[model samples]
Target: MALILLADVGSTWTKLTAVDSNGSIVGQASAPTTVGTDIMEGFNSALSEIRGQTGSKEYSIYACSSAAGGLGMIACGLVPELTGQAAKLAVLGAGAKVLQVYGYNLNEDDLKEIDDLRPDILLLAGGTDGGNKKILLENTQALADKVSPLPIVLAGNRNAIHQGSEILSRAGFSVEVTSNVMPELNRLDIEPAREAIRNLFMSHIVKAKGMETLSRRLAAPLIPTPAAVLAAGKLLAQEMGELLLVDIGGATTDVYSYGGIETPAGMVRKGIVPPWDMRTVEADIGMRYSLQSLVEQAGRENILAQAPHQEQWRQELDKILTYPNRLVSPGLEGLEIIIAQWAVRISVQRHAGSMERVYTPAGATDVLSGKDLRGMNTVIGVGGVMVNSPDPKGILTMDSKGLLPEKPRLMLDSKYIMAAAGLLAGSEPRVARRMLAESLAAL
Candidate 1:
């Protein structure tokens, strides 16, 4: 029987899954993601174990990675809220943590900050096609020869991309030029830039994260782990109809919502993208690295209300803060569940939009901002929190009550196979669909 392999090399663990042509589960394995030295050690270790279990050497391998702070980026554009926002959204969709955003121009201070941050990639975008070219050209000139070897995705004014590309290329830098992210006002085209980011991650980010060995061994381009999961979520949503995905992890919580949104008649959405079939990563609400921020947001009142032993729980969490990899704490199940719940609440609150009263000539009217996922029928949970918790669905149903209007029937990705299925999505659609259906069956 022909076999296929899929893996997600995450920040703490490398999860490996082996499936057959029909998407039948063969075996699975995991190892601590080796980061101190070479990452290939852990990647190969998991692969070897899965191979040993299946006893098969001939298989196609596809992988995604979120190791070592996956794909940090800084975005620059002509306008802070316009094209810059487009660039930010584009990179974020490509599984990147946009650390900083700049608009108009880049000076010595900006360059220094970029150097200091040393982002995985720089997404430079600006003006609509046939619009302002001064900022894109000036920014390119300032960045030329300064940020050498650091890859830049020039997705700016189409009229100026040629000149900007020439300037940056002459300065000994790798540049990927894509079409304007905002070809016209209120028209955000991010697919080209997103594709560029993915391609560049394969070409340059692997080396940046010390995954050269794994990169060389892989049969196809590696995807950012978050992007891989988002792809899987999209595919599953298409098959199963509208769905919401909340994946809680050590460093971040990502929420993916899929559906076709109905816009108000005659009103154009200019403030935010529809974000339909899109993913949002909440960097400040994880179980470990962002635990403090989570605590601050969730508040002492909420924690005490849920877990009365707040002091004890906080103490245990403090220890885990030092080492986020120790996500599973024995005898601290209650605390972990509560933390995951808080993460779900805060993350979903941010991921989904709300309506507010706005004053107009006609009087106060309701204006909706962001994607409304109230009508979602399926809610899939993944990551350590959902997979390990005894009551994984509780995190969404009980804690995510206010944010999610209607209770979404819960599904869990306990096998850590969703990302693997996402990897398969590119190669075998039928198999990917079947595997995800199998996962959702547990709901």
Candidate 2:
């Protein structure tokens, strides 16, 4: 029998899971992640504690993801609207947040704003199919001048790759050039850029953060928290065939959707990859850290719109934001229900919007047309609030309202450890699949 150890190093918590040869979970554990501390130290301590309990000398595999340090990025564009949106999409796709965006008309103030952000990586893009090259080149030059030693990804016009690289190199800045995100006005090509961003993340961002010290200590490279989630999503998509998984965390809600293809029986499975038919939406609608974003998106009107009896919900939400650690008050049961409902709505809508953009061909009319999204086969719900609701009926509430598919299976990250399981699954597909099967069975 073989054993595997998995860990998901999140911004707020580190979740650990131990699985046996048959893919049954043996033990689960969690620990608070020391935000500013060396990630390796925290990871090692958690690993030690898990191993101590299991008394396992050797494990078959180990994997991890991190959200603590903040996955930062700078987005560049030719036109503020088209390429700009494309650039934003690329950053979001990579599971990182955009700290800044620079476009053709962006002035010195914009550049300064970018500098102030101190992003982990910069994604530069611009121009329509074969439009302006000078604009992209000039923006690249300006970016290079203001920020040196920062890794830059040029995902602009395909015709300008060489010229873009030359300008950045001459300025002594490291640059990686990829395919045009907006090759044509109507079509967006972002895979090449997404790949380049991940590569640069390994080469530049990790090292710059003093994470290199920890990298040498660990057996594998550390992954950004969102990337790990994305990796798990890709694996699930391949295995489950067009599935939607939503993980609501303390700081953000991550939605990963797979709309095509099942993993072949013989091929080895690993983390999510580009070109895989999938979409992700990360909303600030978290239970704690980013509750404000959820409130803003859900709005008092919308939240209260559904629950007329929850007049104090807004006050509770405000109070929760101020003191995140407090437990949900008994009187606010309806408010919690409303918040969960609203979060599900916003998160699912965002997920579906991205899927529609990617899967829906222009001018095509099908019953699943933007109107019939409810027909999607599977929707997997994760996170503490959804999993540990005092009322089991809450899960049913999501199902009834179409927030979760009626046929969906709800799996709680009971240990808050799916990320780690996901990372481990990347290397051991059979074990991952087995664990997933068992998880669903238990659910």
Candidate 3:
């Protein structure tokens, strides 16, 4: 008979659900997010209305995820190729929208590009462990000197920590330092930086968005939309044995997989693991927002590279980039199918790359061997882009060809905000598990 409130505050909408003990959604509501205004007031108003309808049962937990006020970030690296890629991976992993990336070789115009974007967080990472400290340090110094005092996460050479911290602090910038993302030429350790990034979001980014005004009124910390997704993914995986979740949003496409488990001591009762058994990847390929990034990655040449008509393919991509959020018209119907297919393919590939990197530790022989395409049991798809499409056939086309690995049984998210359910699952496993099952059934 327990009732739990789950909410996902997206950039455009705030979705809320009230789930009963048996995992049935007893109540649900949606509202436009009051960006740049007091979020708490809007949230409270929404919750009050839901509570009134559902009956005032004591809520066991209040869980949330947010993408409001833009979780924008800029990534800086020593080498444009290596660390830049790593920085992008980490940024995506943390669930923030990366506005731009800069490397040491980036010229004045590059710096200007980042400055113009006015990102909330700057992720600066470079150099392998005990590798070139000079390049990372110099880049950090240059960025500190040029950029306004934004929250900077230094996840580069471990040796450069004290010096980089001092330099950033001297420049009056708030800085958090973590382990080298590229600890070795062949290995990348992104957990520390990922954690620091999430903390920064809670401490600085949310505050900047004026979410703190609302968060202060709440009991728990205001978590970024992506972090909450990660949290929920972890719980789902642990509870259901193993799981894969795909979130295709308007701005980015994210894939999260959770496999294996080692239950913690105190957390045995409450299913919160100190570290997640989950791996996440975010591709800036949404129906809107970073639609251009999707096009760039898939490449006009690569996507059209195989097309029977090159000019037509190019023209369609242009149209998609121009009107990313527009519905597929009769004329461009085929083209929309092509674009969605390519976007899903590229997005899934990126997700696989992140999963392989995170799950397979350095020199681990039997890595991801048991669970490849053949072993995956379930794949859940979330977000409006996937669930709310007019043509189930078009959605199924992507699911069959683009979104999932070959072997898994695919399901759509009947409730769009599973992350919120996941967060509560940490505290109330039985209730959360039931709700998740109900959600799966509804889908």
Candidate 3 Cα misplacement greater than 4 A, ranges: 1-3, 20-24, 57-65, 105-107, 207-210, 239-243, 258-284, 288-342, 353-375, 390-404
What are the TM-scores, per candidate, against the unseen true structure?
Answer: 0.92, 0.81, 0.75
Q: Predictions ranked by lDDT, top down? A: 1, 2, 3
The regions of model 2 sitting more than 4 angstroms off are 207-210, 217-219, 260-284, 301-315, 330-334, 354-374, 391-415, 441-443
What is candidate 3's lDDT per residue for 136-155, written digit by digit as tens? 77866776778777888899
Worst 10 residues of 1 by lDDT: 260-269
Indicate which candidate wins on lDDT. Answer: 1
Pick by TM-score: 1 or 3, better one: 1
RMSD after CA superposition, every candidate: 2.5, 6.4, 7.9
lDDT per residue for candidate 1 within 67-117, as digits (tens), equals: 888889999988777898788888888888888999888988998888889
TM-score order, best first, reads 1, 2, 3
Model 3 C-alpha lDDT versus the unseen true structure: 0.65
How does candidate 3 fare on TM-score? 0.75
Candidate 2 versus truth, CA RMSD in Å, comes to: 6.4
